[model samples]
Target: MTSIYYIQVEDRNSMDGNRSNTLAGLKNNFAGEKEVLVFSNHATEITEKYAQSGVKTTIYQNDAYTIANFDAVLTKLKQIFRSKTDYLLVFDNDSLGSSLGSRIAALLDITFVADAKKITETPNLTVTQDIGATSAKRVIPLAKQAVITFSCNGVAANEPAKVDVSSWSLNEQTKQQYRQAKTAGNGLAFAKVVLAGGKGLGSQQQFKPLMKLAQKLNASVGATKAVTDLGWLSPERMIGISNLTVKPDVYYAFGISGAVQHTSGMNKSKQVIAVNTDPEAPIFKLANYGIVGDANKVISQLNDLL
Candidate 1:
């Protein structure tokens, strides 16, 4: 059986080489299989190198299918697998990987498993994955076809060999305009006031007050890596190393514990005010003004005052 591994070319460098490592692990797991296909958005030097390394490489690139254009990408992907009834599709369990893989699975009506930790083909092809925030494990049976996102730390370099790279393109439909959701813009980098939140906000619903506050204050909304990781906010709103770096004149942090990954992005802000329930939260040390209280209460009080 052949397994298709999808790699988002743009995130290859940002993810600390996890793509190559995961591909190596996949190759190892499906050893002696007919082939392990490398499907990517763009045929970059690195991906082309994979083609040179004995991997079956395929690229589907077009204006309508770029990384920023998920709808177009999704449409193109559905077209690719519309007729396939039995296959294995693999992706890294990272943000982009999981999002794209799961979306594709949903659109194609294919079985989906996320954050896979292990794969075995004994009595049946089953996947072992963590459940309930890593507190437990569950084994899923892959009876026929499935799409999976996996995380592994093992590294395996591809051996050099010759192979051909296959290219795929979208069949251009009638010209049309797409209306996308509001995205965090470069204004975040130049905003005079920024309202940022972190994991301490509790849930995605509880995070709404902070966004409402940003609207009332006419400030840009920012997010800690943890918040973005939880899908509470878009990745574009993330403030951290490798993400957006902001130096707003004033930064209001709600429930932020101030991990270095977050502080590095906004350390240049002229003034910092933080609200958190934990008096010992690290964000207070760097805050020019600190409020030791529930972030939701603080937001509510501020909203009421406004």
Candidate 2:
């Protein structure tokens, strides 16, 4: 299979070192000529790093290419990647990667799979996912061309001889214009500590104390999709299946019911402190420390002590 991995780099000065594993995972999982696509203004570091790590890399740097500008990104991708590969793979942990995979698959009119747990080739490409709370798994045979976003945790990283790098830039302007919104929780992905609230928190005003607590701890604030949809928090702060995924050093889940959608995003946190009114709340299953109490009252007491 001919595969391509798309990685977004927002910071010109730094790159996500963890993505090396994702790139290596792609190379290991599917046998083919795999390439890395670095989408950023400063792609040199990433292109060189991945290229030296044994994957052919291409850099796409355009001034107007922002996360909010989906049309521009899709157009550029169509120009470079459309009909050029057998499989398109992206990281499942981030909103950007997973979202792009689906959109691009639609644009190319190919098979699209999201959040795949495993993929194998017994001479034919097949994907598998565990059925909820069951021993059985769902296996699907993939089409000739497919786009898949999957987890990279268990995949082993490999180092091979460095390859050459290629670059592409847009000299012409795009017809569509976009204004990027300055939303809260942009730092949620890299936050060392996160304070996340769910619908169980009661009301929108309840988040004020959570935000205050986050400020005190120098942590980022996050909200479940239910909270964001109700306007209690910005959509960017949402952490769930179709939103941002984070692996913080410490995660504080406030009043969250611990649904699979929400837990999947933060299950990798080093330490989880969950607060909920229900003693049997599912969040307790994954929490290192569980407190069966009102989330707002706990926040108020913590604020006073801090």
Candidate 3:
């Protein structure tokens, strides 16, 4: 039977909801034959979560934290290559796991699918690519085995496996190497309520009211790349391509025109509300509710209602 592997950032202790989505998608599609392997710097926390979810197999790196040290990962990959499993699924953040899957496939002389949005097996192996707006699906004949990296938003969460934790070991040299190079800039991913502004806000000065509204709601403030480029807000606060991907419970778009790149990141939000002066802004198409009027005015009125 084929096995699925959910690879995540090692040093980061928190369980990735995105990984959860990928695993969920695999479960929905592959069902019982899948197993999750969590690779992490702090193995205890992540492995415990995996065990709770019933994934019996776990791998830990003694010193592997960042992608720079691929030794431990390579070792783990070699083990997977030896396993009887015919298919391996890898998940990554952005392009972090880009070349890892390809290298493993070459080592094992198996078919490789990089940045795949969807995967299915039939007469041949099929992979889907999510290339902005259009979905590209292709079929590849697998000569030996296959390794694939799932794209963001491609797969939903799978039902967690049922099992107890099993032991695995990592090299001490690799552990020491990672400890020396570890840095603190690795940021946290939060589930926030975001208030985002865009070019329609007119001027940088016009963004203050929006900020105040966000502050009132204790929400994180966000902006489109245009607003950030204009010095209206910091790049850290920007949402969309060249910015952060947020899946907040409530996402408020104040004056954002909703470019596809922008929407691609936040489209997963549970609730989306847009306030724009133009009734025909593309954002309205995705928003659950929309107010077609001056963003500043509508925001002020909503504040009063609050």
Which numbered prediction scores highest in TM-score against the true structure? 2
What lDDT score belongs to each candidate, Candidate 1 first? Answer: 0.69, 0.70, 0.63
lDDT of 3 at 94: 44
lDDT of 2 by residue, 1-306 (tens): 645564444333222213444555556666665666666655554454454556666666654444455565566777766756566555444566677778878888888877676778767778886687788888888886777777554222234545444445444465443333444355687888899999999999998789756644656889898999999988888997878889999999998999998888899999999999999999999999999999989999986664
Model 1: residues with Cα > 4 Å off, grouped in runs: 2-18, 32-44, 52-54, 63-65, 133-135, 161-163, 171-306
Better of 1 and 3 by lDDT: 1
Cα lDDT tens digits for candidate 3, 1-306: 445666654554222212444454555555435666656656564453454343445555443355445555667768855766566656553445666666767777777777676666654556666655665555544443667787533222222545333444554364433332121112212445778889988998887677545534545677888887889876666678666788888999998999988898789999999999889899999999999999988887765543
Cα misplacement distance, residue 85 of candidate 1 (Å): 3.1
Which digits, one per residue and each the tens of the lDDT, describe model 1 over residues 1-306?
Answer: 534544544322121112454566676676534244433444454454465334565555343333445565577667767886666777778666788888988988778998898888777778898887767889999856678898754334436544445565544464433333344443577677899989998999987777656644546788999989999977888998968889988999999999898999999899999999989989998899999999999999876554
Question: lDDT, candidate 3, residue 231?
Answer: 92
lDDT for residue 160 in candidate 2, whole number 0-100:
53
Candidate 1 yields a Cα-based lDDT of: 0.69
How many times do residue backbones clash in model 2? 0
Q: Which ten residues in a row have the lowest lDDT in candidate 3?
A: 180-189
Tell me each candidate's RMSD, in Å, in order. Answer: 14.8, 11.6, 10.9
Clashing residue pairs in candidate 1 are: none
Model 3 C-alpha lDDT versus the unseen true structure:
0.63
